[model samples]
Target: MTIPPGPYSPNPAPLLARALRALRRDTGLPVAFGGPVSRDGRGFVIEQLDGARTTSLLRLRVQAGAGLGGRALALARPWVVDDYFAAEEITHVYDHAVAPEHLRSIAAAPVVVDGAPRAVLYVASRSSVDFGDRLLESVARVVQLVERDLAVEEEGRRRLAAAPPALHSAEVHELVAELSQIAATVQDEGIRRRLVDVCRRTRLLAGRVPSADRSPAPAVAAVRLSPREREVLAEVARGCTNDEVAEALGLLPNTVKSYLKSAMRKLGATNRVQAVNLARAAGALD
Candidate 1:
């Protein structure tokens, strides 16, 4: 599949500002800010101040796998440093970037998709304590939310491309509604563009098809699974059994089986294996 180009322009500044605000609200850390950084590309830069005096800090460039943030991006996981100067795994690639900011304690988490790091979220504190798992979890939650929005936008594009040429008027309307909803909920500029692209394509498709004035047919609603159902389906796609899903999700075997059944029904699949395949086709497992 062709990866959609990054949408970094339209709402990135506002999104960065919101991310900074969320970091502050979630962590209460002295310096709660993060932005997308690219080794070969520009990164998002955001900052929040807690004091009356606002100070301008030096700008720093980060390379992948170098500093704390780079390491997080490289590993596609979260990393923390209690004392930046004392960390043994420290890569000096971004040391220059942190020096001017007077960064000490730092934590970073990768915003990942398809097992690749697309961006990094970082939080730094002047205090001595390491940024704990609680803070990391908060950052991860935000990243996951962003990734989900991205995924939905991608799916919308694929669906539009594959839509039947003879789609009924009601089908066209439903597709437009889905496109609008996804666009509204998606935060990433890149994903939003993909959603719009799908909308545009669907409009083009609609124009090519003859319009009918009869009562509209019921549109098929795209299935939305709960987080647990999503997780279970993901695991099932990986060849996990009910017992394995139970262990992974910390649920009873019966509960895992139940989730699988419900997921299958929602996906309109006859069995677990079929559900996994259908889910993947629907881009739920992308």
Candidate 2:
């Protein structure tokens, strides 16, 4: 198959911002921000500058292998500089960005998705301080969360890109959807990963078929049921009580109830029975 040549569709900006915020919250860092690499995958552009007093660092671009951020991205690991101006490992490519923000110390952690550096997360301080191992460890945890989410998003895109020559049938779509729900509750990591790959490819196959031949609405149709809501509703359709749904889905009972309520609201039904009826009517369920 001829893979298309272009940037991956997953937007790392929102996730990057989230990871930065989590980093700051966890490590008590005064400033935290980062951005995705350029579309060609060569440079870093600071799109999500959080905890900044001034907008001086917003949209700051750093070339690959240039600044501290660039080096982190280029080498695919975390890099720390005790003093931003006096750091010898990196050039002053982003000095203009650093000084106006009064950042004296910083560390950059690269979030890698699919073996490539996708974003560089930075935590900084206005005063000179050491970016030590404990902070780095905390940052690593945030990076893991970010990378997990990015991998999920990329798997979604690959579903679209991997669509087969023929569009998929409704039965095929239904099978894949059910399999995904089953996979969600699995315990083994390797098995879960394989199931995810299977689900992605199955979706890719299911999407290529003529729309008319598919199961109910697209997973996210106009009267969209969120994936979680859909999962809960699917169980409810089988006469599962809220507690039962919660146990099956590995969710809190209150959380299951919340998903049920949300699903009911979205389907414009006053009760679970009515909601299931509406879902079936809309082809959102089998």
Candidate that would win on TM-score: 2
Clashes of 2: 8
Indicate the TM-score of model 1: 0.55
Q: What does candidate 2's lDDT look like per residue over 25-113, in tens digits?
A: 99898899888776566887788878998888887888889899999888888999988899899999789878888888899988887
RMSD of each: 11.1, 9.1
Task: Summarize candidate 1's per-residue lDDT along 1-286 as a digit string, tens digits.
Answer: 1122443222233444555556667776666555554434334232323321234432344556767776776666788898887789967655654666676887777655455444556667766864567877777777787557645654665567667758765577567656656565665655565565555566455556655643343222477877898899877654466887899889999999888888888888776655654564455764
Candidate 2: which pairs clash?
Answer: 167-208, 167-209, 168-208, 168-209, 170-214, 170-215, 216-283, 217-283
Q: Global lDDT of each model?
A: 0.61, 0.73
The deviation in Å at residue 127 for candidate 1 is: 2.1
